[model samples]
Target: MKDIKDINKATVKNKTVPTTTGGGVKKVIYTLSTIQRIGLRNSAKALTSHNACKACGLGMGGQRGGMTNELDEFPSVCNKSIQAQSTDIQPAIPNALFNKHPLLDFQELSGQEIEHLGRLGTPIYKAKDSQHYCEVSWQEALDRIAKAMRKTPAQRSFFYSSGRSSNEAGFVLQLLARMYGTNNINNCSYYCHQATGVALTNTIGSGTATVSLEDLNGCDVLFLIGANPASNHPRFIHKLKALRERGGKVIVINPAKEPGLVRFAVPKSAKSLLFGGTEIASLYIQPSIGSDIALFKGIAKAIIEMEAITEDFIHEHTKGYDNFLTNINATEWQEIVECSGISREQIGDIAKIYAESSNTIFAWGMGITHHTHGVENVEYISNLALLRGMVGRPGAGLLPLRGHSNVQGIGTIGVKPVLPQDVFDGIEKNFNITLPSEKGMDTLACLEAAYDNSIDFALLMGGNLYAASPDQQWTKKAMDNINFKVFLTTTLNQGHVNGMDNSEALVLPVTARDEEWQATTQESMFNYVRLSDGGIKRLDHVRPESVILTHIAEQVLPDSQLDFSAFRTHNNIREAIASTIPGMEKLAEIGTSKEEFHISGRLVHDYNFNTQDGQASFITHSILRDEREKPLPYTLTTVRSEGQFNTIVYEQKDSYRDTDDRWSILMNPATIEKLGITENSCINVRSAHGVMNDVKVFPFDLPNSNIMAYFPEANILVGRDHDPRSLTPAFKSVNVDIEVVERQPSLSTS
Candidate 1:
């Protein structure tokens, strides 16, 4: 509600960065806070440090953190040290290895474990506090995992999957877990997109995006709700920028007005540079955090009042149309306006544009999916899209913006405990076995169980559970309670270095997608499975995830019992994925190109209703804005910044709102004045989960009454019980009462 120029500490127009050797330029904003200055100084220190990049574990390539993006005159004081890190200790790719057969080692995968992993993977561990890791062979590691799985109770055992895995590998892992007896399989989606899946599918017939990335070109109106594509998914900028140039309208809705949502100059575009770049969004709607439900309900109401409803489409392809309309209009306009922090006129205008556009796309980021009603919000969008027949049309559809490439792929592979019956039946028929019918636990359920000691052996496929979960202190303790733990990862991250480890915890190094996996084909948000074979090979001493998982299953249970050897060979596993899932059958063949692979058995991208009755499913629910008064003085909103990826932490000194590491919390100016807090004042943020101390505060770009917090740091403030339907932790909604710390606490405990 204030001028950005006055609030933003830094300006982009005053600074200029290189676009490229030809003539591409990108404008980035930053504040000149002491925190930023110190961070920049420390970065120069680390770039010149003896340590690794700490994010991707890539040895400091001669470039300084230095894989790419290195320049002379820059890093002058720090370049030498960064170059030393990349070339010295252990080469990312040794010169001798480059000359060998594959040009890259098939087993040198220090992978992601090298930097973030610290010193954990040198010889590996049987548990914490081991004297020395006598280097174990691949066979030995596999045997150890297998032996542990067999001894552990199936019900007591639990699985954690990361989005980094491929379809073939994920499918094999899920199958192995189900075959083991317990259906308690959990993937990263439980933390990120589970709500979106539940919400969208119930509203429309399908869960994934209705249109492919290629379909964006023809979109006439794009609604970017609770999303910032520039920092999260840069590739999407190409599509959005193109849409803008075509005279299309883009509406961005969020608690904070992200600069990327308003404008972006793509360094990859040519015509844009000639014209000094086109504007990205036509209007930016700043709403209160966790008020997405209210916002959507208002939009639905407006569409109805505007008479934009496709009456024929609703009658022919959708059910419960009348009821849904009734629920949408059930709420009073004044209440919606007060709750959403957006005007009634703004809501109606966006809906008018949406109903008028020939093609429209609604894309949302974590902001929409990280709440208690994340699923409900997703379903709301789907039903809204269905009303206007936006889905299954060119440049128009529901796009669930996913974090970490191919998290959707894991869903397609059915890693959930509640495997879709049709999917389970299909896979069981192919394998000729009766799969378990029990629904399994999600991330929150698994964590709560672990706290109660329900989980026996826990295996994390690629995430840092201890750090990623809310109520960090509690989550960390629960992890330690597990009898056994195993992580299949590329890097040594924060979670790996300081998490709970019982007597049987192990870290297995695996090749990153950047490195070549013999039989792996990665699926993107579009469900496009691309084989990333640079003709490169996995490193020595390391294995592909599929290979590692299958080998472990075989060691624990032989082929006579499960025949996991078939899953060991990548091709066989690919075939298994093809047969088990309806859409994945196309990946049955070997390939080295980006191929359009089917994931859902139902027809999509053309709006063919695939419900049991061959109609789009519609849910009519009244939007209930909890005007509940917060007992606390402040409300905390978590957010992702432009510089970092989700939980990956690539090291950016400045945040999207404050641009300073010192002030971890960004408050509205009015909120700050109301609370009587000063800049850089230390305080505590509390929610149902727990409380946090020493968090810095800043007046940011958010609306009054909303406080913008960051992840991993603010994650602990969100509670597990906040999730509405899918049991996914609602990280977005947290009412925190902030007050100055009277006296500093002891050094160690948070």
Candidate 2:
């Protein structure tokens, strides 16, 4: 048998390319090359266009011009922004794409390959028995979708939205769903940051970042936990570097020692990029997977022992401090160390750094929220922040590093399974229609319901639902069980093909946010709304998402009290949003006034919170313990590559990790040695849900007994088990066993 190293030798080398720093000269070259690949003029136009960034939710671009951030800083672009623009500006997909390729053939393509197939320019539909999709007119597609929705029961239909869409589109979609008599409305957040929302709301009476860019600027220390902003949110690296330059401390806590977190070269800084990059993390801590609560408890214990707790803040601005303190004191240090995989000395050292900082910001990503106890993890993080009086104050608070640019906006505009009572009543009062009062299913519930043959129709507005879901086989089966499914997309993804089997599905081509005809608004993670001045359409056949949604609403609910046809105009929808969604009144003037504004009541700069008593509450929880008899010896955490965003694979190689293969797992050398496996050997990784066979293994700088792999590809090994509170699947921590498929000679021994 051929050696696995010979199959993908470049990936097996496991070398750090050009040192450990991220976004150096390589990023500049990549940006210029991307611009060359897509026409320079198109790239320039897209970059300079007045649109919110389509990448992470760090809030870049808008009225300040492209490549600018919320702080009005110029030339703030990153590789993520460039890649997204290049993909958007590509020429329309060949008119004969659907005709030339069968549905089954498309399923064989990887996420990156499908993305490179170019943008979807026309509406296409596949019949249940059809082997290929055929192009259909917009009218025919809308009519068919309306017909299906009209016949289907409201409870059996679910409306889902992706974060890539505009706030106007999200608002209109959710409104249509409610008007159609279903509260089964959800967005992609349920799979990503829903735990952050649930935890923050319960603790501080708000679900978003309490601090803004200004707060980040003034922070004395940043506690970055379970997040790699260097790869996912490159613009955020600038903040870290700036904070470091000002003598601020950065504490990073994760199982893997990410190279970018250690050091990163700011692309905009010539001296930093050409020279050695700026130091980022002052201290890096690695703990066991699924042990965040224990680590946090350790920190809390250390803080209490050192008398670092803010007694005045806890007593006056917060509640439940006494009980929380009791639990922290009662918790034994031995248990904390055993569960966290960190020494007591190290935990105390971390607490010391946080305790010394007068103002600290607690920021996290999916790594903190992708476990069975995801909500508890977030709550514990909040607990630490509250202990230091970090929350509800300037330059300090909880910041969930949201992935998509408009994901926060989507949730803010009522695209959820349940709406707040005020917003629910306001929608009814404004539209003169009574919405369904029944409880609705979330994203997971919707899929499970469909799998059980209880759901008949699904409308997904802009996201790869199949690739983003856990337990790939189960998600596929659930999608197939649905009678009809509609996907509004700008480009092809695995979901377009693999998500459906026996179901009839429609792929509707929609214009991107930058290509829309009407100006739209998007809210950033900081609760700041920005206006995007839409540009000329790249494809004539494609329509705006708002327009399509309004047309479907018109067809589905004709003669309804709400004037659906009027909503086809984006400004009308904005007016409706301003009237319904509290703190969104600024959206009404955003279209004409061109004034971007922040939504009120989200950022908590003062001690007062939105709770009934106007004080933040402390939530206490015992550290999570896994007592189950495990079938696997190692824990697996699914992570995104530097070349990828969410489930979309912009590139197959991860330059930061220096790996050229996506179908590979990163294991600690000690674990590989203990398992009697050599580097570059092919192995089968099995989890409770599924198995991935013949995967190449590479040694990485992860903690012992823990392994890392890229997401979506590794998503198959992730189980359907999710946090009971938030329902977010445990993507970051899973019990997996590796079986050797092929043995390769060790390079060192050879």
The digit string of per-residue lDDT tens for model 1 on 324-423 reads 8777767888878887888998988888888788988888877887777777778777877887888766767888787755577777888888888778
Output the worst ten-in-a-row residue range by lDDT, candidate 2.
Answer: 1-10
* Alpha-carbon local distance difference test for all models: 0.64, 0.87
Q: Could you report the Cα RMSD, in angstroms, for every candidate shown? A: 9.9, 3.2
Please list the residue runs of candidate 1 whose C-alpha ends up more than 4 Å from where it truly belongs after superposition: 1-123, 126-135, 270-277, 501-503, 534-539, 559-561, 592-595, 598-603, 625-629, 655-658, 741-750
Worst 10 residues of 1 by lDDT: 14-23
lDDT for model 2, please: 0.87
Candidate that would win on TM-score: 2
lDDT of 2 at 512: 86
What is the TM-score of each predicted model, taking all chains together?
A: 0.82, 0.97
Number of colliding residue pairs in each model:
20, 0
lDDT of 2 by residue, 1-750 (tens): 011000111232333222357778788888899899998988888889999888989878999999988788988889999888877887777767678777777887888888878888889999988878988888899889989999999989999999989999998899899888888999999999999999998899998999998899989899999999999999898999999999999999999888889888888898898786888999999998888988999999999999999999988998988899889889899989988889999998899998899999999999999988888888888889999889887899889999999999999999998899999899989888899999989999999999899999999999999999999999999998999999999998999898666889999988888989888888898999999998856888888998999889888888789888888888898999999988998888888898888898988888998898988888888876662234578899999999988988888888887677999998877666666667677899999899999888777777877999999999899888999999898899899988988865444533
Best by lDDT: 2
Q: Model 2 off-target regions past 4 Å? A: 1-19, 627-631, 745-750
Clashing pairs in 2: none
